[model samples]
Target: MDLREYSVFDIMGPVMIGPSSSHTAGAARLAKIARQIAGDDVKEVQFILYDSFANTYKGHGTDKALVAGIIGIDPDDERLSHSFELAKEQNISFSFVKSDKDASHPNTVRMVIKNKSGDVIEVLGSSIGGGNVVLKEINGMSVEFTGEYETLITKHIDKPGIIAMVTKVLSEHMINIAFMRVYRQLKGDMAIMVIESDQTIPEDVRIRIEHIDGIEKAIVVDSINKA
Candidate 1:
């Protein structure tokens, strides 16, 4: 098996404000990814923290960190100390529930967020140490993407040539796709496509994708949080 070498910074730590990178920093990033999926109109959020996060989140400021992220603050920001007050000021209601499920990652966090229009979405993520995170699930579909590239998530009905049509739009925009993956519930039912690209996907590309014949939802996210 090939081994991935750890950088010095990876071995040491990331510049962050937290008691534990896994509990606090990782949790913050997890919430940040969830916020991206839920969009800015979020009104209420429910966090389902599992294992270590559930047991010691309060003590380690993991709860505050998650709230800070939902408000668009990074883990390294000083405002993380006042995340609770900030959340209250925004009127974003939230609840934390703990559960231990077999076959689930210990550092997993599942978030259910609701918007003003009563639109609700669920996202699951895991913090993989050193402030890095992975987007695990979206709206009950199993998908995965690292927060390392300009990512696009699309939900559509499974059909032939849909992938080609989507990529063609991106190509027209001159966007280079670094990675692409498709996941489906069944052969001909719903499907989720994840694309991580070298450059940000333009708003027009997203709209065009949404306008496609079979596409249902098209979400464009920047790993740099530019969106």
Candidate 2:
């Protein structure tokens, strides 16, 4: 059936496993997607919930669902109820914060995840409804993605001509950039680049990016489609 045929209430009403579909199921899915983007072997996580999520998370099991997802629990698993104790047993550290931002979505969540290697990543996402979500930002870029693309997330020194240099390599190799976003922390000194593409980045291109003058690091996030 075409999703558009369903009314918002019709779509959201059948999802009755939680306190609120947007707050609970959507929150769980958002956390799961963030975990997928952050990769496995995560050692720690921090979840910040906004507005409605903040107010009802504990009662709705949104907190447990988020924690369960980071600990690698499947969303439909009955073990989600024990996720916190499981995390403690597994030695995975986690914390929660509530942010009441007037500008944020009611079901928005910001997750900071750290892998065992101490590499850190931050993802901002929102659960729209019917257990659906969109990753709105990563590392401060205004990006709209579903965590289903082969990706490269990089941080570099911001400078003129960097885009041409990177795109040149892809163009030379016949790779297509499906989506690209750049976030600048300072005018010309610090920036992050997140690129989702139609093909896997070759090892040679990865090495070449590391050698580029203004680039700091070019790390390929594993294919979300494959994961």
Candidate 3:
């Protein structure tokens, strides 16, 4: 076999120090992205790793890397060397579970997060390759994003004119949304909107969004470059 002709995976194969950069590093990045989506002041986090991730998470540092990432640590940070202990020091509660499901990518992970105010969020993501990731779902919404944008994620009851209301608020603040995606469950009763913007949303706008009717929760995630 011409190793050079093959993708990096073919050359490197499965790794143990980490489950190839695509899985472990990508998992770390996904965790970081989830934290970004959850915003700061996070208190508790639950991680669900699927398929191959479940089989070798420990050896790959997927567990440690994940906890470390959630705490706002970089994947390559040596502090990850003691992430389990560091997480304890930081008082960031974290746990992990393994699941067998065809619903998610083989390298997928789902994050259930809670902030200090008790606001809860659930995000699903996948580690694609080359330490890159795509946020595949949020709050049960099937969406595709690179997880790098400064974003606002809102969960609410689906109703008429909610998008207009939210967008109007953002527009009034001069925040330009680069893209918007919505996910709704069962006749649009419960919904989630993921808004990617060119820049961060102001605190005042965020506060205003919280007051919007039908909005259950609003979270502002700074870009990973900023985090």
Which candidate number maximizes TM-score?
1
Q: How much lDDT does candidate 3 score?
A: 0.79
Q: Taking the tens digit of each residue's C-alpha lDDT, what string does model 1 give over 167-214?
A: 999998999999999999899999999999999778888999999999
Query: Scored by CA lDDT, what does every candidate get?
Result: 0.85, 0.76, 0.79
lDDT of 2 by residue, 47-80 (tens): 9888878888899899988887787665556677
The clash numbers for all candidates, in the given order, read 0, 0, 0
After TM-score superposition, the amount by which residue 147's alpha carbon in candidate 2 deviates from its true location, in angstroms, is 2.0
- Candidate 3, residue 26: the lDDT equals 76
Clashing pairs in 1: none
Pairwise TM-score winner, candidates 2 and 3? 3
Question: What ranking of all candidate models by lDDT puts the best one first?
Answer: 1, 3, 2
Pick the winner on lDDT between candidates 1 and 3: 1
Candidate 2 local accuracy as lDDT?
Answer: 0.76
Per-candidate RMSD, Å: 2.2, 4.7, 5.4
For candidate 1, report its TM-score.
0.91
